[model samples]
Target: MNTRKILYQFGYRRCADQDRPSPARHPVIVVGAGPVGLCTAIDLAQRGVSVVLLDDADRIGEGSRGICYAKRTLEILDRLGVAKPCLEKGVTWKLGKVFQRDDQLYAFDLLPEDGHKMPAFINLQQYYLEHALVERAAELPHLDIRWRNKVIGLKRRNDGVTLTVETPEGSYDLDADWVVAADGARSALRGMLGLDFRGEVFEDRFLIADVKMKGDFPPERWFWFDPPFHDGRSALLHKQPDDVWRIDLQLGPDADAKAEQAPERVIPRIRQMLGHDAFTLEWVSVYTFQCRRLERFAHGRVVFAGDAAHQVSPFGARGANSGIQDAENLAWKLALVIRGEAPESLIETYDAERSAAADENIGHSTRSTDFIAPRSAQELRFRDAVLALARHAPFAKRMVNSGRLSMPSTYETPLSTPDADEWSGSVRLGAPLPDAPMRNGHDQTVWLLEALDGEETLIHVPNGGTPPAGRRVLVIGHDLIDQDGFFARRFDATPGSTYLIRPDQHLAARWRHTTPEAIERASRRLKGLDGEHA
Candidate 1:
């Protein structure tokens, strides 16, 4: 089937141009209708903020790019009300095996323990995910998505930003309180703002093929170093929905990208790997990898997210996952600032937090690229030795880095209220809330994360103590029952312990015992109101 036909079937409709005059101003304007842009618009709209989403194209993504979504990303999507469709249409897996020239070196289980709500990773085509997000965006009344709307120019102001949008009929001007640029790696908005990325561009290229075939390959990730079937380089295989599989083949810098993508060249390669299995090529692309990011994500009235803020190698699947996290991190802060509920300085925390995450992703992606495509002979020999030792030596197995899979970045900032006492669990104050099963007041089993409905929640493990009173702060003990003790063991909760959770479900502060005054103080500090906390 043709790729365009698949995209059309997924409901990519051309939006009508506005016949009326453009609005004088919008609360938020999101550039690019890709996953990150659509997610940002949806998040802000869900928070009661009006948003306008723009995209140059009238369809979803063209190919199966960024096919892997991490668990943390899935949680963020769940909050956005699209995780159910994503989970149903994607292939979930946690086990991955690494091979060195057809010999299995070792295997790893990303989530060996059960009790978590989401899997380690899900493999779904980016187009499918984006289509789902667009459908969800349509259900919201506060979000206005304009297709074939291109951002031709932008000017940042002290109070707001003005953008020149070009539609098929004509061009119009739009003023926005805030601008979120998710236009992707080669962002036109970034170029218009005279911003550039600073980092290393590896001298290695990769070929990606989306092949459809009837096969029995398990849903686990399989990676190989110098595979015998392909050339002496790295390769990766992942299963997606619709009997389509994603395959990556390493092509040296000097390889001809066009020639490699040709059917005459790709068919023989697939035959060699699948041993003459019947298959059809769905899509193909060749591109180099770069580990790069802008100096700052937030620039005055305009901000950047996803590929516009940072670009990483595909080895770790960090691009879209981190981008979704970026949308989650920025949405609440932006909404608060726009509604005058928080000071403008609160937006600065988005930079401090996401920049740290970008650095972590870049560091890991760079290392993975170096290990997969070593430049020097000495480096290759060292990598080979480590791979050989990983077959038997358990210690060496830990050193093998086949793309240190994507994980959430812990933010150590003033926005997070540190623990006043020692803790003995994996979940920390600055980290996102770990998932656990719980029973609600109606005796319905639900995940702990489900209780956090985009609002600040105060959790207390009752020990014959009265709970605090607040207007918007949800008291969990009143409606939640931890019948299985999973929350206690996972969070190290004790009698009289109080935990303050932020709107994004991240732990803001925790204390052995606390009063309502202390909780209010921490909450104020989280919004950048308290001087000392700021």
Candidate 2:
């Protein structure tokens, strides 16, 4: 009878007619309609703001949670216009393989760098990217969504939030200046604001399935490790396009009858990873989830996005691309503090830059599940001597392309700092500014992240500009002749590279030769403005 009375007996109650005066009032609301509250209510109704959204499930990607999408979450669904219908119904991959244990192999290609912006990942299905973000939040007419509702009480006064939803046309009382909680990971609003999520949990448990195979297997992403059968555990194998497949076993550590993972123990572990090659089933389950976070992600007019502010461990797809980059960094700073045009300490830098990119993506997904399942035995012989020097050099292929993971940044937070160019080598001020290629006025090619779609760009560079007035800046000029030389060796614009980005593109602050009074004090503390800026 603990854990705070079993999370207040899974609270979320609210009803018995409360003082109802709201249908709107700086109305924002949001709260879990999945895919980080429908991409934070279609990026706060494409910044016009006035959202409602809510949801207790009544349509919208019902389960089989977060399939996988990276490549910076398809460049943030191509900056919220829903990435060409999620790349024409996803399932594109360049390559991936990784097995180890007597049948060694280590492929991996994920092509990128040709009109950049996105490539290297996309295998869609988390209810088909929540059916294209609830069909672009049903063509936002100032967005209203609702469905089964259920925010069940929130309160927080002095300027906004009242919540206490419940609908099907019943309990109400909404009033909102803000309230987002892309709810999940047991986040009944971060357990009704008692906060503190913390982490570490892995007594092994996983089974996932979703068969219907016919293998020649090569739609990439394999990852085995001690697999000759489920006898030694670990197996992943995803490919879901039309031929469908998405396994993932590993029930070890006291596998208490996970409802007996049948189909004769999963078609003999897909006949030991494809020896007998016959397949056809569809879906299976057995989760045991754990990998936490949340020690704060704003809590006043209530806030918290994606897995209600962090969950990690779906190994490197970083929980719905870090909850759609925490709803594109809290939808345009909660639509410029509900249109009063900022200043609310810019929502305290969305809990200090997404709680420091959710603790560096939960310490790189708990070190990729402790370097592929190793909890001792001297950390599995130092992860098999770094996978036997990552199978022979090229500095372990750039250390497996720096653990092939992306999107998660920070610049020491308090809305980013570090400027006075002490520039030397490895500058990691809120990393992620990699794509390049250019030319878009009508001569073809593009990608300085396609002019950082829908808001907050300020790139500058090529002798960085003087922006900071209603912010937009994307200037990149420095003659690499606007489009080739591999995007001038990956975004080579050293005429004092600026960058500001953030609209879920990451890198929220940078400067090498920047000063229009430090871009008007980091654009008035990242557009949450209020006075001071010079």
Best-fitting candidate, scored by TM-score? 1
Q: Which sections of candidate 1 miss by over 4 Å?
A: 1-6, 9-23, 471-477, 532-534
- Residue-wise lDDT of candidate 2 within 287-402, one digit each (tens)? 76567877888877888887877787786678888888878778878788777777777878878878888888888877777766777899778777766687776465344322
Report the Cα lDDT for residue 170, model 1.
75
Which ten-residue region of model 2 has the weakest summed lDDT? 1-10
Candidate no. 2 TM-score: 0.36
lDDT of 1 by residue, 1-534 (tens): 234245733322343434446646889999998889999999999999999998888876578878999999999999999999999999999999999988998888989877788889999999989989999998999999888888999998999999998876778788899999999999999999999999999878888889999878899999998889986888899999999999889989999988888988888888888887599998888889789999999999999999999999998899999999999989999999988889988889999999999999999999888889989999898888989899899998888888999999888988677665878877787789899888887888889888886777888877787776764543456677777777888889888887888888888888888887788888888887876432
TM-score of each: 0.96, 0.36
CA lDDT, candidate 2, residue 518: 74
